[model samples]
Target: MSNPNSNFPLTLKQCRVIREIMKKGTEKEASSSLNLSQSSVSRALSQAEQALQVDIFTRGWSGAEPTSAGEVVISSCNSILQAISDTERQLQSNVTTLLKLKTYVEWRHLLIIEAVVKVGSASVAAQTLGMTQPAVSKTLKEIENMVQQPLFSRARRGLIPQTAAKQLASLFLRISPVAQSLQQSLQSLPNELTGRLSVGMLSFSCQDIVPIAFASIFKQHSGIRLQAMQGPYHMLANALRQGEIDCFLGLMRKGPIHPELIELPLLPAQYALIARADHPIHNDAKTLNDLVNERWIVARHGTPIRDYFESLFHSIDNKPPIQALEMLTFASSEELVIHSDAIALLFYDDWNINKLTPRLKQIPIPLPKPECTIGITLHRERQSTIIQTFIEELKLTIIDKLKTQ
Candidate 1:
């Protein structure tokens, strides 16, 4: 067995001594509990504190008191000792079978087992595995069939591991060492972390161009997985708040974004009035004032588009034309602009990128020349490792898009 003092090769025993001293108070009390000499305890603690490069305790006339560093060490020691005890117990029970099982299975199955140990609920394990409960059950059943023994037992709330699972857990007791070794061996690998990211984009932005760019990125970083959803800005905002999405990709002309969200500036997209080629306003609405009398198809209130459009019109005329429709989907809105006499607001870059210019004409109306604040946002509290990575990839993709533009 490797010595805890040496394996950590730094501070575990020192931390253990400090924690014991804090719990017992005074050298005599700690020495008796740890079955060590008072001098040994004192020396070990001093050596540990010195090795860790921190003072862990304050000696008082009455007893020893834990300093801030001592308290921190105590917390760490508790976790370390618990893990060590668990490891010891597991190894005493099973090690050979586990080594064989781990060699045969993929790492993902091991990850699922770890999740099961953490959650103690098969249903929750299923969700974390991104699988149905039936699928999780079937997988477990297959494992049992392969071993010819029961691995878990059904309980009132969740499933509990049986003797077979206990044996597996014992085998898994060696996981940290094996995992550490595996991780170290793979450390020099040059691959993006593999995971799915769900992003919400403004309707106009998702018009084939953006997703196509992301697909190219995925091809390059094959480890990266992508999932995208699109709707009006408000719908995306609501989804962000509810933690249903990872990031919001769009303009932010609206006043006061939610305090909970973090918005990062990307590219500058500009506004343009788009109408069907046959629409009368395409030729008539040449200036800002001319749009006052023209009927418009604006995205509903609370959307970033509506905010920017309203503000730009308000700068010229006190009243803007009422929206003929409050459509949400880009398809519906695009169709409205394509088949109707009504003029709709669009981001010029997006319209140009999507080949939408064929179906719609940019009315030469000079509005406030508001540039779309194309940015990305997500609820500040909801950032995960995968989400942050996706945001970085998105920014790179957007920058590349802007360079070509």
Candidate 2:
């Protein structure tokens, strides 16, 4: 069974052949180690190189050696294999069993297991996978036999995943993104870049950099499709972890973050309290205490800006304003503040301040400037060319914007 939309360009056997070549440093040694004939190993390497559109190995009298591109591909293969090995260990399986599992497993098997686990019904999974119910059931049974474990249990609602099934499905979910990115990178030509990139945005702070960077990317690479997903930091972070989005742009959080994600700092962020130019509080309020009782518009809870807003009052030994409106959108917050007496805490960059000027003015109260960073968050293992290009554009945009300000 083959899917045209499958993200993995290479088969399991091809990956295994590549891995053995990497470890043995020669096709002959690799074939011997893997118990495969020399012709079979050569064919696997040739097919893998052709599929990826890159020569993974350089052949000579000594043996086959990996090229720079081959190194990257091998690293990705190692990660996928490591994930499988980890899952095997978690299930109390031995090395021999792990090797057998790797040999017998195909990408479709992983996809089927993920589908069945996600939908919890064979019929539904069949429909999702464009297969009949019997086919789905039979494939799942084959997978269970291979693993030597019952992956699911019957229930009135649907099939419930057992511990082994859950672990196996998790392995697929975690490695799928890495494998997809690897394939995209290796298969794409530099001048003809093509792929779909999903970026998650946290609130409006990302507006300053994301739009301009995306525009530059679109102008240069029309073949690439860019999509933006917006939500709070936690939701976006979860989506990034689950591989729903490739990367996120927004204020970086303080404290320990997910181990599987990496945060690259682009610039420092400063927050300011602002009010309408004609508001009475602008003239009467000399300190934060003076505006404590006035209506306020703040970011939604669990956001970095909101945390900073609350901490401002906490530092002064006072509760935050009792009368306040919590908002997530910059437009809504700006409109509410402009039409009413409500004040807001917002990004205080020169670009933002200039945009809000003549209508809204920063409150004169002195505030502490904490160390806050704004940047891109991505999967730790992801090193796709498209993602790198977008990040470069973001950095350039930030530098240019700062220079103008």
Candidate 3:
């Protein structure tokens, strides 16, 4: 097993100062907030920078701005801090529990826990982690000992993550992405080309740009492995932030909805309210109001697209359909709407429509909302070479295929 100490190589003071600077925004601000001198704050920042071997902040007259590397460091540091806070709150740290945890708990334990929860089996986690089953078990036992609770309940099907395990795993999920992004960053240093790139995208991207980019990316670099995960924007955005996926390609709201992740526009996407060709309102619809009684299929709750549907109704000063099914896949929603008496709000794509044509048609509702910007959402730390390469191909594909549409 890899040594745990090597991974968590930051000092206590370094952890303290990362938050201070992130919150207060500058050495002077941190010093003033923490009741320390400016030089102390500077030293703390410098020490953290030296330990991390990356520029965590750009110091200038206007204030401190985080560079890409800084963004990664801050993200990872925030996870660590939050995890520590959770541990303290749950464990109620006495001298012994505190000392035992401080001495025994390492970054690897959380990694193993998260892997187990993700894959739902110790054996699978072992295989994924390239460790023996016994080794993964031993690590989980160690984690249980440190936390003084059973994390997983052995089940007939798989390990059933209990409350403690689930909560702890959730905290680790936040950290794992930063750790993963860091590894990807190291792998994709400007001179080297070896790395894995995973992009999570939704329907609009799948209709054209993403696949085209995928083809070009594979053709250019046989050595690199490329993967894609499809889901709604909110789910994929959570994945992107957790480092579950590098970025999510789809329709983005015009302004900044998420400060941690940035959106770069790829194409203009216009919406259409679609129903099965035999749908009652397909020919008669004059406005959104004509379809208020129809059933609806939508992206999962809290998703940008699903929320956009809500905003669409509010924009027209109309009440939306009362019912919803949280089907995140556009294809699945399309299939359901094609056969059932429901309608879907979708980006206008002939490719999406052409395959299932004669069965599905667009409602004649006059949509007054502005066209949505379809694009990719990149986390603050996603400026690495491999990610950049993939995004470049996506843009090129857009220019060739989707720019006009």
Using lDDT as the measure, the top candidate is 2
Question: Candidate 1 residues 219-265, lDDT tens each?
Answer: 76654445577777667777777656668676665543578987877
RMSD to true structure for each model, in Å? 18.9, 18.0, 17.1
- Provide backbone clash counts, one per model: 0, 0, 0
Clashes of 1: 0
Question: After superposition, which runs of candidate 2 have C-alpha atoms over 4 Å from their true positions?
Answer: 1-191
Local accuracy of candidate 3 as per-residue lDDT tens digits, 1-405 = 455434544543565677778788777788887777889878878877776676676542235656556665676677776666766566544324442443345567877888899889999999887789999999999988877767888889999997767766776667555554654553354443544567887754555567788889788775455667676666676767766577777777665466898988876666778788887786677777776677888776655666778887887788766787767666678799888987887775443434446778877777766366777789987578889998889778766663343
Models ranked on TM-score: 2, 3, 1
TM-score: which is higher, 2 or 3?
A: 2
Give me the displacement of residue 18 in model 3, in angstroms. 32
| Model 3 root-mean-square deviation | 17.1
Candidate 2 lDDT, tens digit per residue, 1-405?
A: 447235587777788899999889788899999899999999998988888888786542234556556767888888888887777667656223433456567777788889999999989988888888888888787787677778999999999999888888899999888778886766464556666567888885677678899899999987566778688887777777766677988888864278988888888767888889898887899987787788889988888888888899998899987677988777778888889988998775556666665888888888887557777888998668989999999889988998876
Candidate 3 has an lDDT of 0.70
Model 3 residue runs over 4 Å out of place are 1-192, 203-207, 232-235, 254-258, 315-318, 349-356, 402-405
Candidate ranking (lDDT, best to worst): 2, 3, 1
lDDT of 2: 0.79
| Residue pair clashes in candidate 1 | none
